[model samples]
Target: MSDFGRKGLGDQLKEKAQPDSTKSTLDQTKESASGLYDRAAGAVQPDQNKSATQQLGDSTRSTKDDASNQGQGILASAQETIGNAAQAVSDTLQGKK
Candidate 1:
């Protein structure tokens, strides 16, 4: 057989482990958002001038904002992880290093 014909499927295949770049990046973003949310919540204090109902409304709004922000962060992080995993799989199948 010719040299080209003699080459097996293994000979043309190459693999290299893909390094993950998302972990630290995602962690930092999550941490930063958490810190920001905490600071925002902490900054809200009972106002002596405001009525009881107004105070309650302010507290409720702050809690809601914190929950909503945290939920969004979780969702975004999950999506990023899934996308990274998919990309890694695709790269591996293509014999990329």
Candidate 2:
């Protein structure tokens, strides 16, 4: 009947329509954490032998250092690829006629 009464009813309807907003946010957070874990796992390959802290022969230690450097290089390459893709998209949008 009154404007205030109608406004209260509208607010109640909105609340009832979306009761799982908090659950959706928690699910998104879990999904993001899972993705981060997977990425970190992929970055570190499985080493059959001891870690870098363990003492090893010169050749073996050098090989390990090279592998570590290679991993960093790969990360740089992936970053560059992502940057190039973003730049391409930006250029395409700006070049639109």
Candidate 3:
């Protein structure tokens, strides 16, 4: 099971947590391009007017977007949990909790 191109959970979480300001220029450009393409596609072909194959493509894209969003949410929750644990430990050490 080579995971070559796929990001590991830690990497994914780190990426999700990274501030937009710190993203590479290339990454930002790519995101902008993707957004533009999506907007153009939507304007050109509203959902109800798509062919069967186009509808399938749209569905696949939607599913992928949904999964990515869910992954980011999970990562945020994990980061919050870890931060809270760390804070609790610090407070205990300082006799504040």
Using all chains and alpha carbons, the TM-scores for the candidates as numbered come to: 0.50, 0.37, 0.59
Error of 2 at 38 (Å): 33
Whose TM-score is higher: candidate 1's or candidate 2's? 1
lDDT of each model, Cα atoms only?
Answer: 0.54, 0.51, 0.65
Clashing pairs in 3: none
- Best candidate, TM-score-wise? 3
Clash count in backbone of candidate 2: 0
In the range 7-83, model 1's lDDT, one tens digit per residue, is 22222121112233544777657555654653454355436644454455456656978999999999999999999
| Poorest 10 consecutive residues by lDDT, candidate 3 | 1-10
Model 2's TM-score against the true structure: 0.37
**Residue-level lDDT for 48 in candidate 1:** 69
Q: Summarize candidate 3's per-residue lDDT along 1-97 as a digit string, tens digits.
A: 1122222334434555888799999987876675556536744666677655556655665787899999999999999999999999999999996
In what order do the candidates fall by TM-score, top score first? 3, 1, 2
lDDT of 2: 0.51
Q: Best lDDT goes to which candidate?
A: 3
lDDT per residue for candidate 2 within 1-97, as digits (tens), equals 1121122233323444655555477765764565455334434434333233221222343586699999999999999999999999998999943
RMSD of each: 27.2, 22.2, 11.4
